[model samples]
Target: MNIVLTIDTNFAPQAAACIASVCENNKDVSSISFFILTTGIKEPAGKKLHTLVESYDRTLDIIDIGNIYQYFDSDFDTAGWSEIILARLLMARFLPVSVSRVLYLDGDTIVRRSLSPLWNTDLDSNLIGAVREPTASAERRKALHIADMRYFNSGVLLIDLDSWRSNSIEKTLLDYCRNHKAVLFASDQDAINGALATRIKELSPSYNYVNSFFYYPYSALVRMCRPAQYISRENYEAAIADPTIVHFLGEERPWRAGNTHQYRSDYAHYLSLTPFSNMPMEQGWETYFKAWRTFNTATKPFPMLRYRIITSLIPTFMRFRAAKRRRT
Candidate 1:
């Protein structure tokens, strides 16, 4: 299996733990290669990562791709979001052409089991395999141009490089971005969904069990995302109970001290085995003090209450709505 990832100096330690999870869990697979597209990562960080991967007798290649994202137009940038979105979308540019397929994992993901099944999935005519994103689907309807079209998170992508190159997926995405420009507020995600919605093969949610699944019940989450197609409640519960890949996104990231993420111990377990085990654990007091955070958690049992709170908090001046307005 060929695995690829992108990271910066700040994320080296977290990425190391992520890689460790992959290596440790997929030990059954005798042939696994790791390709890391990195930026601004210095000596000791690089050295430490190299040692960890090699200890498991796995191959590791760190490609230093510094500030190349600056070449992209300003349309892709949002105030707080990093340029890492640009780098991740350009993974095909950095990976070897000889590699027909590569599994792209974000630095925040942890592999929980053998990924042989996911790796062996048939892409057919599709350019990529990914799980559908649940949050903010209605807000992205205009960007995706189809109400029923699936919008996927780029956090965990199983890319078919052969199909990508043969069909010029990269060029298509770039052209779409250029055409839509600033309207593609979500940048990488919008570009992928807008350009290649029909060409994507939806993977089972088990593959990328996101942090949201930990808090919201399947029924409540379904009402929240209102996706065109979703898994059965039983499947959702099963996947949540034993997820294949644990993705820590938003503020519930396990690395922070005060985070109440359900799978935080899993992250700690992998990190303990990595070279960065000694990394400090801290979360801002402000994060803990947020009234909304406490309220959100408390209202998890009552979806209606949470929805009302969210809608009230969002400014009316913004185009983004907390939830889709119901049909009469």
Candidate 2:
């Protein structure tokens, strides 16, 4: 199986943990190859990763993408996004021509199960396989001009490189980004969905169980807002029970303190096995509070107003009781 990850220096430790989880869980896969795309990762960090992968008897390939953007020739605004985000867009150009299929995982994801089933999934005529974004509504899909409600989260992608190249997927993505720069929300993700709208096969939520799944109330609120875009309750519950891949999708990460995800301990378990085991966890109370405030304030206007009024009118103890009820 061919697995790819894109990261920079700051995310090297987490990426290593993600790889460790994959190696630990999928030991039965005899021919696992890992490809890392980065822009100038420190030699020490690279060596640590190399040693970790070697210990698992897996091949690690690091591709330097320091000057990759120079070849794009587009004026797309990539300010908020890392250059590494663009690496997946050009996977067809960079990966070996003989590699027809590759699984591209974000650095923030940890594999909890053997990927053999996902790797062997028949894509039929699809160019990529991905899970749908839980927060994306049908209204959001229409705004992006996507024909169907198939807007996928690009965190976990099973790509068909041959199909991508034959269909000019890369060129199409670049063109879309270049022409509609201001409209892009999640840059590479939006570009991919826009370009391969019809060629994407929806993968099960278990393959990419996002961070929101850890907090039931928040996840339910998101689903209630966009029932059509979200996965069914059965799939969500199954993924929560046993996820194939756990994705730390939002700003809160396992390495940071104040992150209360159920799988944060799982990430730490993998991290303890890496060379960066002694790395310090940063305090994130402010970050957590900010996220909480944003969540309370940023829903659709009607929901936001109702939430604020309900919270304000209810007694503090009663509100606490209500929250505890929601969690169960």
Candidate 3:
């Protein structure tokens, strides 16, 4: 299986932990190779990561994509995004023509079990296989001109590179990104779904069980994304019970020291196995307190709306507590 990840220096530890998780969990897979696309990763980080992957008897290809992404910087609305977002789309350009497929896992995801099923699923006619973004806003969908609103998250993609190369899908995505700068919300994700929402094969949520599953039930996501086809509640429950991949979406990631995510220890376990084992955890007790306190604010008046309201304030609450701690 060809697994790919694109990240910058800030995400090195995350990338390592994710790689560790995949190598540890997918032992049954015979030919697992990782392709990491980056401009430049600093010293021991690059060296140590190579060692970690080699220890598992796997090949790691680190490709430097250079400054090709700079062309998009001046035109796009890049509020919170980095250049790595643009580099992700250049996979078709960097990878060899012989490589027909790739499973692109984001730095924030962890593989908890065998990926053989997901890797082997036949993409009959779809350009790519992806999971629907549980909370794709209506406005964003409209901006992308997606009439059915079947927008997908680009985080964990099972790409059919053969189709991508032959069909000029890469050119299409690049053109869409260049032209629709005003409409792009999630940037690269918008480009993918905007051009290929109908063309994308919707993977089961179990393959990309986003963290939102913890706060909103499966029924709620079904209601929100309103996907034409969805899993039964029983299957949904089963997926939650043992997701093949756990995606840490939004701000509440497992890397934080006091994060309340169920997978914090799972992430830590993987991190401990990586070269960046000494990487210190960020945030503290205040983060844990603020998180749960805000989460409990879920109310009858637009439950998700209310949760977002409190969730937005958690940073302020944590800052106040941190200041108090420093004074003492």
Residues 1-328, model 1: lDDT tens digits: 9988888778888898889999988888998899988776798999999999999999899987777656466544432345566676677788888889999998989999999999999988788999877654476565568567667878889998988888877788878877887566667777888888888898878888886666566776676566476767877777678889988876567787777677899999999999999999865744553663777769988875665555464444133321222221
Return whichever of 1 and 3 wins on lDDT. 3
Tens digits of per-residue lDDT for model 2, 129-187: 99877555455466678745567889999998887888888889888877766767567
Q: Which has the higher lDDT value, candidate number 2 or candidate number 3?
A: 3
**What's the residue-level lDDT of 190 in candidate 2?**
84
Instruction: Give the candidate order by descending lDDT.
Output: 3, 2, 1
lDDT scores for all predictions?
0.77, 0.78, 0.80
Candidate 1: pairs in clash:
none
Scored against the true structure, residue 250 in model 1 reaches a CA lDDT of 62
**Candidate 1 global lDDT:** 0.77
Q: Worst ten-residue run, lDDT, model 3?
A: 71-80
Off by over 4 Å in 3: 71-73, 227-229, 284-292, 300-304, 307-328
| TM values, all candidates | 0.89, 0.84, 0.88
- Angstrom error at residue 227, model 1: 6.3
Worst 10 residues of 2 by lDDT: 306-315
RMSD of each: 5.8, 8.2, 4.8
- Predicted candidate 3 versus true structure: per-residue lDDT over 189-234, tens digit per residue: 8888898877898887788888667767666667666534456788
